[model samples]
Target: MAEWTIGGVLDAIAGVIPDRLMTVCGQRRSTFADTADRSRRLANFLAGRGLGAHRERHTLANWECGQDRVALIMRNDLYPDAVIGCLKARTVPVNVNFHYTPREVNELLEYVKPSAVIYHRSLGAKFADVLPPDALWISVDDGGVLPELPSAVRLADALVEGAVDQRISPSPDDVVMMCTGGTTGRPKGVLWRQCDTYTVSMNGADHAYAAEIAEKVRHAGPPWFAVSPLMHAAGMWTAFAGVLGGQTVVLYDNRETFDPKAVWATVEREKVGLMTMVGDAYAGPLIDELQRNSYDLSSLFAVATGGAATNPRHQQALLEMLPGITLVNGYGSSETGNVGFGRSQRGDTRDTFELRDGALVLAADYSRFLHPGEQEIGWVARAGRIPLGYFDDPDATRSTFPEVDGKRVVISGDRGALAEDGTLRLFGRDSLVVNTGGEKVFVEEVEEVVRAHPGIADALVVGRPSERWGEEVVALIARAEVRAAVTHDVLHTHCAAHLAGFKVPKEFIVVEQVRRLGNGKADYRWAKSAVLREVTPA
Candidate 1:
């Protein structure tokens, strides 16, 4: 029989691998049996508090639906339990970025209109004022003094108040809502069915080997670590992929910020075989740390990254630091999961990815698909194993998830060219493309050149309104050192050597730092503002 729901798959794996390690954090460890029991207890507790699948339309907001939504407003450590419980209870898990401001948090909560909220006690004060009165609040203690909130009940207390054996079988169509548009704009919930998400994003087991997942785990060495924040889909998908493969998940517990030393320490101690990060934003620091100190990273065989751009320079730096280690740059989004994988190796194109069978380069018109060997630029699209749609936004659902040639596809606004050899050379997001003097320049391409500079820490490329050209390309840079020997002429010379003159930045603005989202994606909105602020007269 096909395993329809995520909880069912987890249970099947746990039943076989009962004593296998499931999760490991700073001081917390859980076996498969322990994970199952805790999730069951939490599921029962949530059910008792009137949290279960409700498929009626919500009366509160026009852009709201009646899926039993459980918002998670905590750090990465509590994600596995909350996500598992939500799945087992037949409820949708909505990821809430705890880093958002109170206003942003309020906006997301209002839009999602969740039936329950599982949050860290540290954040209760930040979001307590905006929570829905009808929503059940379960607070997880972070071993810190938490502000008293009248609406919250301790998670430990709730776990003991409910039955440990309560089980509810969910259909394959049950929703698992993941919020996209991180750290910018109002968050939109991407609705994905449990089974589709599992097969497409998570590494689901074949039916023949489903019952033997434990034996596979018993033979495999080392755990998988997700270095990215779990609130984002990439990290959550990494954790799920590890669990589905019957491998233990080693979660980083540093809630403050990205600490490369601590991460290396954890990897060395746990013998993490595979680790996931988010592009060059993470790779740069990890490479710098390797240069500073050495660790027993022999157990680590592969490192994977997604959700942002990873330039070839960063890949080369990593390979230089750790020879023979595989570096994978994954191309994907919340709507289109696992579109393609780019193995960063010697002589590989910097930003190019090998297209998976289901991945396609659709014509800019979206009328037909562009075949391989077509030199025309097209939107990168994917068919088969895509999301259901954006929750509560049927219009957006129709626009993004369109049916082409009698087949459904999801186009997440990424633009790329299909090469003669069938490899896809990603140009970057069409929305962020800068057109200067009738010539199109991809910011990501230019940014890659800028970031490749040894003296530059980070860079953001934006278009500034110009009298001569329609829109001139401007670069905002963050220096690697306090007094680095980097200048406008030096950068221009570097970029000119690699790219066409029009694609080079006309002006460079030096800043203390470049803004990035928690998930390591470029804050284009912030970059645009910074460009305007610098170019405008005082």
Candidate 2:
């Protein structure tokens, strides 16, 4: 069988379905032939500049990389091109959060130590002070009026100057670095071999050879729309899944903010069959728009959400609006790729996933794997085709991906227990657990009950330092409207019936908006700070 590297898969698919549409972003659309050609040109350009793999994976430590790193700091439009090109050249493409502050950007860049940086020209001024002196800079046009970097090469010029006919070879061991959002702490790069990534994230497990996969894609599938930023793992995985399946990948166009109307219009115009989003942060707005306006959404067959806790109420509302559509709730993270998934049934409020192959719940003591009907809450983990380790952080890599019974597994930090029937009963992240008055409480349990309230639009639960108790749970809520009939007593009564007394929040602070990361994961750091500011006396 051919090696399952992303570059090899791309070559096979392009060879078979070169005329099919590969990507669509607003007025921009590219065919497999065009995208493959452009990617080859970019690969040649970077290779000519002496950037490629310097050593194989076996020659380096788990926390070390010998490939030239290229930081991608642009939006979703040309992201596939950049990644494919880097892979073809045997270089690692690092994802950069474009919404990060200058300091955060500097910290990430310092850690990754990329040999090249590609960013949108509109962001040139943001990196002027902190950009490394030795790295090559390339800028893409975002149709914005901003000063260009003096040392950066325009992406257009580089593509034209690049040679198109050079032979390229990419190894399966080439690394792909995915950086965590760093909401709780500093961002860590999770490195995965390209072949393993393809197996775990790109449906490589279903086929034995790249030629067979390409032949299966003789007819184009319906377009898959990515409603989240590609810098994050959820969005990137979903988009690449479409590409590997020979489906048209549609990117959300509005970069500054998510415009629900614009998203639906694009879906309608493109006849998108599948749309992926990040839980309720994106679902709530889209639901509100659907209630206010009418659009032809007959083409949309499935709506998949992951990367955060999805509210079941929102899922029900979406199902009611679009009958006969499947609502898929996926479970996975950067460390564990595509662990499991569950579909939302009509009138069901619980989100439970069936563990995929190689996924199991580890015992609380980390000594062995748990069996079906295990009563103790354990850590959710995946054993095969997982990431290598956190880049340059051996301590974290060892802790997160420990060996149990001589077998390596990636612990996803999510606390869950196996049911008698062998399905996973997922709880909130164990890292975010709160201990108040000697009782451990999962914040997600409280937040789930709070969001079930009719008046609550969104909410986040966090722990704050307390005098009587070691730490107290506090809730930050965003109401559906300013005048919504949501009061402390009403929420307290609602939560009291569904949760243990200790799990209930001590106070609920109403906020205009609940802050979230660009990819819609809960910003626990922001929530903790907000709670501190609200409770502390000036």
Q: Tell me how far the alpha carbon of residue 495 in candidate 2 is from the true structure, in angstroms, after superposition.
A: 31
Per-model C-alpha lDDT, please? 0.79, 0.83
Q: Tell me the spans in candidate 1 whose CA falls farther than 4 Å from its real position.
A: 1-3, 56-66, 182-184, 205-218, 346-351, 432-538
For 112-137, candidate 1 gives per-residue lDDT tens digits of 98888999888888788888889898
Query: 279 in model 1: Cα distance from truth in Å?
Result: 1.8
TM-score, candidate 2, is: 0.82
Compute the lDDT of residue 231 as modeled in candidate 1: 85
Residue 420 alpha-carbon offset, candidate 2, angstroms: 2.1
Supply the TM-score for candidate 1: 0.79
**Model 2 agreement with the true structure over 309-415: per-residue lDDT tens digits:** 55666788899998868888888988899998888756654467877889999998998899999799999999977899999989988998899998899998889
